[model samples]
Target: MKLRIFHQTVYRYDRPARNLVQSLRLTPSVSEGQRTHDWQIDVQGGIRGPGFRDGAGDWIEGWTVRGPTEEVTVTVTGRIETRDTAGVLRGHRELINPLAYLRDTPATKPDQALRDLALTAKDAADPLGLAHRLSAVVSDAIAYMPGQTGFHTTAAEALEKGEGVCQDHAHALIALARLHDLPARYASGYLHTTADGDAHEAAHAWAEINVPGLGWVGFDPANRCCPDERYVRLGSGLDASDAAPIRGIAAGHGIETMDVAVSVEEVERFQTQSQSQTQS
Candidate 1:
């Protein structure tokens, strides 16, 4: 599948703000499953800094907006040719040990209930089987409801509520995976869904479990399947906040509000457009 993505985020402040700094993890992952083309990231009135690949194999870049202004906008445009890899993250380079992801984060911490959930899948014969079972368990536990949860909702909390969006499902799955001694991390990316399909967030989140002999395998409990050609992998982290596509802070006491728009779609026809890097 050939997928095109357009993502834009706008920040508005009631009072003038200054020295807005941002860290972006918006670039797609380089793996056998996906190849990126003509990718670009633009931040209005911002300066681009050096970029590097991190221990987790994610591309990280820095940007700064020296603003005494009330607004800032960041836009990303890219194309990815993807194939189904059965969710196995193959041919990707990274320095982090899988065991490192076994550590818990606030968002993925399991409580008594989560522990019990993990126990249900313990009878699976192997790590891969157990991983799939865990994903199914989370899918059954959480009903997909968009407005029922927020960014701060934790795995235990979502499991208790029995309802949430993709983020909650991913968090719950990560918690359960860790309970079973599997190293799990949160993955952030984009999903292409047709209009006739069930409503889903174009910008998506899922969990990646590091299985012995398999490297990292992605599982999306929210969609009840492993990531396929319809998905574009961006980055992974201990939790959602860490894997966020954009993270930043601004100087000044001004109250800030943000709006995000994302569109991911499969293109039947291919067209090439010229793109250039810009820094302000």
Candidate 2:
């Protein structure tokens, strides 16, 4: 599938920001299922710095927007060709070991409840099967309610509430996966959901578990399925906050408000078909 994506994030502050520095993991790395065509991130009134890929296999770029500034806008536009690899991340290179993800983060630390829930996912079956079982366990426990939780909500809190958005699901899944000693990390990306509704939509999140032989396989319990062609995998880390697409600090802030708008859509069906044929 061929898709076009547009994402804009704007920040407003009560007081002017003295200075700002942002690290962006906005570009998707090449894997078996997807390849970026042309992508650009434009930071209004910002100067670009050297960018490099981190040990986790994500491209990290630095940008500085000098302030005395009240607002900052970051605009991203891109085109990518994606294939359905059943959520398996293939042909991706990274320096970090899978066991590195075993460490717990504040947001994904499993509580007793999560530990007990992890026991339910255990099986005498294969490790891959057990992972899928855990995914189902999380899916059955949490219902998708967008406004039910906030960004700071932890996996245990979201599970206790029994409701949260995709980020919550990813966090909860990571917690459960780690409870069983499985190496799991949080993945941030864009999903082509609006093509189904004919409207613009938001970004997407999921969990990737490193199975014995499977390497990294993504599972989105919120959707009750793994990522497919509709999904675009970006950076990954120990948890949501670690894998955030954009992470930064603004100096001299009274109160900062952020607004994000994302649009993802498949190119025309004919265009998709033509692209596929050319590649084949």
Top lDDT: which candidate number?
A: 1
Candidate 2 local lDDT, 1-280, one digit each (tens): 8988899999898999967999999998779899889999999989999999899888999999988898999999999999999888999989999999999999999899999999997773987898899999999999988888998999999999999889999999999888888999999999887444422135989999999988999999988999999999889999888999999998893799999998887888658779899999
Candidate 2 displacement at residue 47 in angstroms: 0.2
Q: What is the C-alpha lDDT of each candidate?
A: 0.93, 0.90
**Compared with the true structure, what per-residue lDDT tens digits does model 1 show for residues 192-248?**
987686889899999999999899999999999999999999999999998999999
Model 2: how far is 6 from its true place, Å?
Answer: 0.2
Question: What is candidate 1's local distance difference test score?
Answer: 0.93
TM-score of each: 0.95, 0.93
In model 1, the worst 10-residue window by lDDT is 271-280
Each prediction's RMSD over C-alphas, in Å, is 5.1, 4.2
Top candidate (TM-score): 1
Off by over 4 Å in 1: 269-280
